[model samples]
Target: MLLTKFDPFKQFKDLERSFYNYPSNNESVNGFVPIVNTREGESAYHIDVDLPGVKKEDIKVDISKDILTISGERKTKDEIKEEDYYKVETSFGKFTRSFTLPENIDIENIEARSDNGVLEVIIPKKEEQNSKKSIEIK
Candidate 1:
């Protein structure tokens, strides 16, 4: 028979690590996570991503089959002067986000725009077709 000791705080620690995206001891953190919001409208679907400090030119939107991917890089500004540092919390790195699109989406008509610090992607839905037909019986 084997015996093991159980710790009560193990679950909490695991949750904290996942929520903060803390890397493991053997891995290195490379990128930041951007907030995203998605909504479905009557005629289209909208994806809004919050990308503060990231320029429009640095962002790229791509689609492959039914997957929509948004990728970009945020560079750190060299504004540190020769003085005592208090606190630095700004994060800068490359980020990529992907979403699986529905079947009715019109890929050719999809469009994206950036205003302020938010990127909005509009995916227009395809028009519904009438497939029912009445046949005259003789």
Candidate 2:
């Protein structure tokens, strides 16, 4: 009779199990909050977020007390019938994100749009008081 050596991969099997069986994180409960990148210019600030599998109708944008909130839900597709299965992996759920706008932003002019799974928000800056000035040299 021959004895085989123990495989090292078996030792890490529990780690793999934990990763696969872990519960959803805090973000999942808040909806599919995405990574947001903000760009500031003299005229406006632009915010971009990646949101795949989410529809325009499912998204909701609200502004209250200088706070901007974006929330949406992504519904999972129905199961496909198949005799032979190889692999399947995808995430689908709700998500919400909020941002505190600067005091100089014009909340009434804010606009948001989703294109090709990316959400873009534009916040126009408030007009500066007496921006135009004449220079006098003595």
**TM-scores across all candidates?**
0.76, 0.66
| Alpha carbon lDDT at 50, candidate 1 | 91
Candidate 1: C-alpha RMSD to true structure equals 6.5
Local accuracy of candidate 1 as per-residue lDDT tens digits, 1-138? 999899999999999879777664323366667789999999999999999999999999999988999999877776865354586555678889999999998899999999999999999999988889999999
Model 2 lDDT per residue over 1-138, tens place: 999999889869978888876556533433455667889988999989878778889888899898898988878665864434475344467777898989999888889999998899999999989978899999
Residue 26's lDDT in candidate 2: 30
Positional deviation of residue 131's Cα in model 2 after best superposition, in angstroms: 8.0
**What would the C-alpha RMSD of candidate 2 be, to one decimal place?**
6.5
Question: Which parts of model 1 are misplaced by more than 4 Å?
Answer: 1-28, 81-85
Best by TM-score: 1
State the displacement of the C-alpha of residue 54, model 2, in Å, after optimal TM-score superposition. Answer: 0.7
Candidate 1: residue 17 Cα off by (Å): 11
Q: Where's the lowest-lDDT run of ten residues in candidate 2?
A: 24-33
- Whole-model lDDT, model 2: 0.81
